[model samples]
Target: MAPGKLVLATHNPGKVVELAELLGPHGLEVVSAGSLGLPEPDETETTFIGNARLKALAAATASGLPAISDDSGLCVDGLGGAPGIYSARWAGPGKDFAVAMARVNDELGDKSRTAHFICALCVAWPDGHSEVVEGRVDGTLVWPPRGGNGFGYDPMFLMDGQAQTYGEMTRAEKEADNHRARAFRQLVALLPARPA
Candidate 1:
């Protein structure tokens, strides 16, 4: 059965809002760790799944509730996936994504702009039971950025066939095919069916 209440292991308001919207229809009430005054744990894991599992497990253990966490990033093929795990760190202390985008543009000068966004999600229970899923969306990078709808690298990521960057798309448009949405769908499928 779906948990009546689930803690989302994150301090990002955008993620909390997006996740809440994605999971709401499943009959779950979502709460963020930040809302409960839970401390953020250091993400020492090297892989996306590992980080997600770490965060989810920490929140579940602390709050005594089932928890979900997502670790997502943009990886550039030409850059050999550097900044993969360090995607957020690229934004620096103030979470300045504008600086991050500039760095990406600087690095890719005159080179292949192929890239992809990846999302790994983990759901953990207080007793240690856990499930993980991953999803990705292939795309190319754009210069000068675009729109202001999405957070992070969305302004520069244009999906394979879409003319608009993720930042230019409406919430519904982006959610329709985003890596996070794909991962969340897989997670929902893996969740135990709600009792009748």
Candidate 2:
């Protein structure tokens, strides 16, 4: 796994930036599938790892290069981990989290606000060989979403024992110990070591 070109199998601008940042220190060149004009495949998988594997393999096969992909979502305890795989769908076609967050609140009513953000990272090679891992950070929901730094449900997620929401924290603060970073830490072993 020498440092080299890698395709990120996602069209999400925020994810592309975040993942690129994470992959930077490894000396790997990162490019989004969307940037490469690769089509997004339907995520028919029921689990995060499954979907991540699907996207990674698709990109790897199409681009004939190593590819990475992640499937992440906010799972609420009260909602029985609903919006789990359908978090994006909950945002509708426009990918509006404001509406999605509102829906979460409405459907939750007075139920527990406990929630967790989970991420599954997958790396696939052109031959279809792959490795996947998952990570999560627990937190609680807050109304009147705060901050505007991160995307999706960040504004509504307050990590355990933290004063600021993920959206309120600086990029360094948010990336320091979030779900994606946690997953990346585990996936790092599969990557080339940082250049000396």
TM-score of each: 0.97, 0.96
* Candidate 2: residue pairs that collide: none
- Model 2 residue 187 lDDT score: 94
Worst ten in a row by lDDT for model 1: 187-196
Backbone clashes, candidate 1: 0
| Per-residue lDDT of candidate 1, residues 74-102 (tens digit) | 99987889679899999999999999999
Instruction: List, residue by residue over 90-124, the lDDT tens digit for candidate 2.
Output: 99999999999999999999999999999999999
Off by over 4 Å in 2: 190-196
Output the TM-score of candidate 1.
0.97
